[model samples]
Target chain A: MRRLWIGLTYAVFALLIVVPLVKIATGSLEDGVSGLLDALLRPEALHALMMTGIIVVFVTLINTVFGVMLAIYLVRAAWLHPRIKGLLNSIVDLPYAVSPVIGGLMIVLLVGPDTALGALLEGAGIKIVYALPGMVIATLFVTFPLMVREVMPVLQEIGSQQEEAATMLGAYSWYTFWKVTWPSIRWGVIYGVVLTVARTLGEFGAVLVVSGNIMNLTQTATTLVYQDVENFNVVAANGVALVLAAFSVGLLLLMEWAKKRKEVH
Target chain B: MHIEVKGLSKSFGDFKAVQDVSFGIKKGHLIGLLGPSGGGKTSILRMLAGLEAPTAGDILFHGKRVNDLPPQERGIGFVFQNYALFKHMTVFENVAFGLKVKKLPKDAIRERVQSLIELTGLKGFEHRYPAQLSGGQRQRVAFARALAPEPQLLLLDEPFAAIDAKIRSELRTWLKEMIERVGITSIFVTHDQDEAIEVADEIMIISKGRLEQKGTPWEIYKNPETQFVAEFIGESTTVDNVAALHGFEEAAAWTGTRGLIRPEYIEIGKPGEITLASATMRGVVRHIHFRGSEWMVELEIGDIRLITYRSLEKDVLKPGDPVDILIHRAYLFNESDSWIMENKLKVDPMPVII
Candidate 1:
């Protein structure tokens, strides 16, 4: 009976997930090599892929640094009251609870031309909404919690004993953090960065709202695929989707490796 | 260097962990900070290591105030209870960490680390990570790492609390030998009285964040100044119980004061010779248990009871056997936790008053 139940679950998973992925893979190559090349090699699609790549890299870098700092503060700052610490801990996971569309709308409200923050930046000739800056911010807003959540647990588990030991051994605060604390949590940081990258690559709703889906200026790969499907260009859409799936698979492997490394420690 | 702590106190919010604790550690002595759990021994050790800032008072090292110095600047080696060796580094690297941070020459760091490892008996385990070592080996690594910087003073917080029972005593002896070889002034905290008595050159007993007493092991055991110390340092019973059993009304006046008598001082006498010649009070053996090479006999005199230790080779005394016990010696303390006088009385069945 247990085997039958497990088989039924696998069948459902296969029908819902594996079947569509297989169909997309086969359908993308339906037009043969040249046709597939033509779809992916189009100037607009190439530009869109490059835009997506740039935004993902920028978001991953910014979020990784900020996420690690936030996690360390949450774990190590002794002066924070319990209530305030709990509030901040919950807010770190705000991105996970809030929808991406709402996250994008939040950025739009803060940086659109009509708002004070947006008008002031515009006067300085800094473009946010409908540009690369706005797209990166939107993606970051949705993926901010991934890295912090991953690193915070590891930091909490390792505790401050080793750090204190280093300080007692004539190590300053910076040296202690670098030599003792960082080594213990590096795998967690790597895992978090990869998760953020994976999430940024697939981000659509927030980027769509903030980037305005500008054809050549801020049209990321996801928006490009959406636009292609709207125009009944199924071949182009499938090609882009297949490339994203491959990147996601690579990211999944990296995340798995990171998790394994953490367990060994 | 000799160290002196004057009026040191630490408070967390509203709770005072260490309050007005003052004591001096002489140069080149292995001192034990003995206390019960939550007795603030660790807090005092942390203050000495500069890991904790006392809420008030001064900490002096060789007459130089170090209250404002950070832990790294204090030049003290601190070993934590859990043997917090760097998990990511090998034993060699862990020991060399401080020297490397100081930017010592490569050869100097290597030579210092190798010697310290050998001193701590971790010579062959230099390449092993902390996780790969046994509990005792890990403690050795922690000790080696703490000593690598050639610190002025060494502080350890319950270093043997994590070791297995079978190896704990061996490690304690080894640790004492190692510290003597290093010849640095050191302080370690422990809750185990036996470990403190066995390993410490001088013991400072603390309770409720206050220093109860400080003296050599024999001094502290034989001449405990406070009621807390007398009860905490060794196995003993109150003198009031002995006085009450013998109907000494004057001795009852010492109640709410201090008086202690050790179990080993009292001995079993023949019940048939019940005269006042050699027995203070007569009682029946209530219980008996073989304790190592000795028999722990409990005696009941009316409603009062006393415990005594006798050699197992002595004639076996069974429960319900009436026996007379002789009171050998007892110490009395005043309200200030100071010894008032020693009352050495000859055992006699009389209403003897002190």
Candidate 2:
């Protein structure tokens, strides 16, 4: 019975993942290796890939710091009123509930050029609407929950006993965190970081809507692939999509590896 | 260090965990906060360790009020019920944590940790992580870690609760002796009266967030000041009435409303086997439970049932056998006070006033 179920699952996996991946790989090589290289090395493709890299690094860094802190606050801060803590917990998960396009729209609505905050920032020489800053903020809004969600369960599982033991032994709060709390939660934080990196790298709808898909200014890799398909450049689109798929596959493997490490602990 | 807590109380919202509890610990004495589960023994320990803020109280260490001191500033050692060893760190690193926090020289830290490892009998297990150690070993690591900084007082919460039955007794004796050798004022919480009686120099009985009685285990065992203490400190069962029992006429003046008796205080034997068989009451054995080294015989005398232990040397008792029962003494208590009621035949009979 188990074997039959496993075979059926493999069949579905092939149709959904294996076949499309093979098709993308073949399609990207349609003009041969040189043609594929030429399309990928094009100035616009290079710029979009660079934009995606920058966003992934910044978003992961910001998300990891705030996310771990928020998770700790949510789980350990006894002084917080339960209702307010519950509300904040749901707010952390808001990114998962709202559509990425709507998240992008919300960010633009709140901080677009014509909005008061946006106008003030723009007057202070900060262009946010069709710029890298807006792309980062929109992506941040969409992927805000990943790290916090990963770390919260871990913090809860380990409980506050060891931390209390550390403090009772005359460890300052920071030292207790680094010595007792951090080591236990490091795997959880790493798993969250991997998830955040993957999500940031592949973010599309929000980045496209917020970045405005300007040629070289804020056009991320996914946005550029959309523009390629829109302009009847299927070969270039396939090349960019192939790269994104490969990156996603690598991230998936990294996530699995991180998960195994976490379980071992 | 001499420790004093003046009206320390703790509440979790509507639930009062520790209420208006106050006690003192003489220097270098081992104390046990003994109580039933959910009876607020651990809450008092946490407050003493500075891990929980008291709702209203003054905690003094060597005559200085430490109510505002953070746990780090309090310089106390705490062993949690679960041990709470750092899973990621080796036993050596776990013990060396507080020393490293003090930024001591590496050699000093190594020497101290090494000595503690030997002291805890975990010499070869130093490199192993907490996951690799047994429950008893993990408990030792917790003890070593807490003692690393040589804190003023050590607080342990239910120290032997996580261990299985066999090793628990062994660890209890080991912990009691280790605390004596170190001679640091220590307080441990336990629901197990045996653990407290066997381990602590002084035992404080707590119930419903209030201090019931505080004394040497012998004092609490022989002369419980409150009904709760008399009922809680041992395997005591409440006797319905003391005046109806054989040779207990003096109990009438005591108004023994809630009479409590310990199994060891009640003697059960074949009619002539009991020394004062003439003054003994008649009871039929109801059930016999094997208690490892002794037999716990349940007996029914008139309207009430009693429990008494028979040594393995005694002839086996059957369920329906009639036996002579001479209760040596029992505790009698009313709402406001309690007193010990002796068997009138064993002591000089006093004139009953009531």
Candidate 3:
């Protein structure tokens, strides 16, 4: 019975994951490599991929720095009243509660081109709703909780003991954080960064809605795939998706490595 | 340095962890903040180390107020309960951390860290991470790391609590000897009376967030001034009526109904081994159990059961046999006061001093 269940699990995994991955890989090479290359070489696909890369870099960097700070503040700030901290902590997972499309819609409703603040920013010569900034913000909103979720537990587990020990030994606060706290949570931070990057790469609904899906300006790879399928260009969609799926697989491997390293201590 | 805490108190929300605790440490004295769990010993230690801000009162180091001094400038070393050795750093790096923070000369850092590693007997394991070390080794690393910056004062919170039973006693002796050799004024918090008595030059007993008593181990043991101190310090059992016991029946020193008897205060012997004159208290052996180096004999005088220890080298006695008991002293306590009551039949009554 156990063997039967185990076999069933693998069969389900192959059908849902392995089979789709193989199909994407083969479908991208339908014209014996020209199809994948032609689709990737198109100016729109390149621009979309580049835009996605930019958003992933921006979102991951911004989220890693602020997410780690927020985690530290939530877990270690003794001055913050526990009640307020608890309220803030409970709100960290708001990104997960609302669907990404709804999150994108919220941003659009608050700061779209037609909104008063959006028009003022446009009059000031800054474009957000159909630009890189809005795209990054949308992805940031979606991936904001990943870094905090990963690092918070690590910070709480290590506690303030080593930091206090450092302080007693005459290390300053920043010095203690650098020497004591950072090293303990570095792997957690790495895990957070990878998760953020993965989510940013795959973020479609939020980025598409917030950035107005503007081709060559705001279209991300996932958004490009959606556009390709809508235009009945299935081969191009497969090519872009296979590239995205390949990066996701690499990040999955990185996550596995980080997890093993995390357990070393 | 002479450290003094004046009316130090701490409260966590509504829970008062430390309440109006005040004490002074003479130079180079090893003090132990001994208490049960949640009795505010650790809170008091943290306040002294400037790790926890006092809810009220002040801390003085060398007669200067250090209430506002951050822990980095407090010139103290602190070892946490679980050692808190930096898991990511090697033993050498852990010891060198303080020096590095101070931006010492590289040569000086190396020399100091090497000497501390050697001093902690971790000479060869300098490059090993904390995860690679045993609990005892990790504690040694924490100790070495704490001492790296050459702080004037040291603090430890349950330093031996993480180690297993066998290594704990050895670490206690090692820690005490190291503290003496370093000649640094240090305070450690622990719940184990044995550890406190073994390591601390003076033990401060804490209960209910209050400092109950403070004295040398012998002073606290022989001259417990309170009922809590009497019953909490050692292997003592409270008695309902001490007046019913032989030798103490007519002693004028006792003025209360409640009394505590320590195992060491009573001696048990076989019938033939005791003199008839000294064998005023005849007790029937109720149960006998083999204790480590002694035989734990429970005896009954009338209806009252008492516990006493007999050396293993003595003649063994079985249950229901009549035996001789000689109680040297017991702590007698009333509602307000406690004092030592001696057996009038065993020894001359001497004035008890603290």
Per residue, candidate 3 scores C-alpha lDDT tens digits across B1-354 of 898889989999999999998889899999999988989988898888888899999999999999999888888999999988887889999999889988999999999999988888998999898888999999999999999999999899899888999998988899999999999999999999998998899999999899999999999988987888888898877878788887777634546567799988887777656653452678899999998888898889897788888888778889999987877787888877777877776653453467
Report chain A TM-scores, every model.
Answer: 0.97, 0.96, 0.97
lDDT of 3 by residue, A5-35 (tens): 9999999999999999999998888876888
Write down the lDDT that model 1 would get.
Answer: 0.87
Q: By summed lDDT, which 10 consecutive residues of candidate 3 chain A come out lowest? A: A164-173
User: Which of the numbered candidates is closest to the native, going by highest DockQ?
Assistant: 1
The residue pairs that clash in candidate 1, if any, are none
A158-253: candidate 2 lDDT, tens digit per residue: 999888877877788788888888888888999888888888888998987888899887888899989999998888988998999999899889
Ranking by TM-score: 1, 2, 3
Q: In candidate 2, how many Å is residue B109 off?
A: 1.2
Native interface contacts kept by each candidate, as a fraction: 0.95, 0.86, 0.93
lDDT of 1 by residue, B78-152 (tens): 999998889999999999998998999999999999888878878788899888899999999999889888898
Lowest-lDDT window of 10 residues in candidate 2 chain B? B344-353
Clashing pairs for predicted structure model 2, backbone only? none
Q: Would candidate 3 be rated incorrect, acceptable, medium or high by CAPRI criteria?
A: medium
